[model samples]
Target: MKLQTALRLIYPPRCVSCGDLVESDFGLCGPCWRETPFIEGLACDTCGVPLPGHSDQIEHCDDCMRIARPWSRGRAVLTYKDNGRKLVLALKHSDRLDIIRPAGVWLARAARPILQDQMLIAPIPLHWSRLLKRRFNQSALLAQELGRLTALSVCPDLLVRPKRTESLEGKGHDARFTTLDRAINAHPKRKHRMAGRHVLLIDDVMTSGATMAAAAEACLSAGAHDVSALSLARVAKDA
Candidate 1:
């Protein structure tokens, strides 16, 4: 307790969602924590998209029904706008290690019920140049936390982004999906490890579900029996 107090005195903690100083190191201030929607209620079971006035028994969303995902099922912690983008950007550029703990915990809480029986965790890897520039992979940080929570093995290098592509920054749906269609590949050595296993792919965000879908296809081609995604946030159309 004394050491913790001294540490706080030296460097007070801050909210993960906001930059306000916190009294403790638990990751977020009271109001900001409460404001973060944990994405509950009736969500799309297949892709984790929020549905309006959905019934619990409905097993799929219109998107999932019309177009099938290569993965088995997925979970997303937030609706991928507002504070969600802030959190992802904080970690991506600001070197916010503190956000990882709470974000991971929240992600674990969201994923636990669905992922209780999953076999392994695989974070989508960044391209070499981007990895060097960023000095970290946000997905890997989230994956490590999920691993710690669920006791699942984290394979940080199971999937790789073989080439750097144009950022999906201003791209429309068609362009974004097409960009990711060939962005991912499996590591040769890891291919054997994925056989017959249910792999959980982790990412900071899922926009258009294109990247995760491509990663899932790679996993399937590499011999994973089943694949699923768990993201911190997901982008959606204006409702």
Candidate 2:
């Protein structure tokens, strides 16, 4: 404990985005904090899209109406815009472990309703081929850290991306969905872990809800009682 305090005195906390010195632990500086596009209120119940109105009665957006999502509900901490996008990119490609704690804290607070006694947290998996190239899976990192925060059972191997699919970055909604349709599944041997359990899936971002829908469907087929999803950011795009 004494050594930890001395280390802290030597190295104070810095902003996650800009690396600017800050007073608090695992936080952003004032400017970056203001710049982050947090999705605070009135988001879609199904896909986490930000709703325009202040009314509480509205639940889902148009996309959710046209689409069939397997997950019962979804939650996101911020919009995939500006600083939020930058942070996600940094975490995904730059090995920015510095942001993991603060980001996981925000996701945990947002996912409170999804966390329950029977809940098991799992991440959307990447195929072994892709995993070898990337050297890490951002979703698994988020889920593991979230498990640490909530004391929930985190089974990162519960799901498997057995087949490698091309990057969905520039793909359209339907195209992405097509690519992910059967790409994800519950691990053959670990199916028992998902059976009769409520799963709270974690990911760094939700773009078309395609990935989450595919993952949730896999869990449900494996006998999961229910499935919901949480993410750090949600893509806001026109349907």
Candidate 3:
């Protein structure tokens, strides 16, 4: 308690999104808080996209019905736009560990329905070359923090990315999948841990779902009973 007080006095508190002053840590200023598009209310059972109007029973989104995801379940806390996109960009460029605290809290609430006692949390790994340059994997940070909050164990080493694929920034949908094909797999020595167990894969963003699809397939091929994916932000056409 004393330590927190002293730190607050020294560093003060700032909004993780807009860098505005706030009352305390892990918070957003009033304007920034309202600006953030937090996904809540009725959402898709499969992809976590907010549904139109109100519903009384479980429902899946149109996209989930037309296109199937490799993972059995999925969750996303916010749409990948506006403040949400800014948050991701800030984490990559600036030293903002505070961003993960609020992200983990939002993710924990979104993933509550899929989390289970025996499930394991694993992050999508960056290729060694990229990891060396970045110094840290943002996805792993989110997974570790979320694991602590949810009392779930995280296995950061369970997955391996042997080759660094080209950036998907300017690629078409098919091109993106071609790049990820056979690019991700479970570590041979760690396969035993995944078999017959549910694995929750974590990532920073889910733009087209290609990365998570590959991760889910790899885990399933290694005998995982089921795989689910969650991301902090997901690109969407609408809520």
What tens digits encode model 2's per-residue C-alpha lDDT throughout 1-239? 99989988899788898989998888989999999988878888877788887875758889999898888888899899899999999998898977888988999988875578868999999899888888999999899999999999999999999888998989999899999999999999999998888999999999988999899999999999999999999988742
1-239 per-residue lDDT for model 1 (tens digits): 99988888887887767768987675777887777666887777778877778584856777789876898788788877777777778888999877888888888887865784657899988999999999999999899988998889989999989889889988987898889987999998899889989999999988777888889999999989889888998776642
- Residue by residue across 1-239, what tens digits does model 3's lDDT show? 99988888889888887777887778889998787777787777777777778888887787778777888888889887888778887876675777999889989999998889988899998999988898888999999999999999898878899988999997877888889998998989999989899999999988767898889899999999999889988778763
Show model 3 residue runs off by greater than 4 Å: 1-3
Model 2: how far residue 57 lies from native, Å: 3.2
TM-score of each: 0.92, 0.95, 0.93
Give Cα distance to truth, residue 96, candidate 2, Å. 0.5
Which candidate number maximizes lDDT?
A: 2
Candidate 1 has what TM-score? 0.92
- The C-alpha lDDT values of all candidates are 0.84, 0.89, 0.86
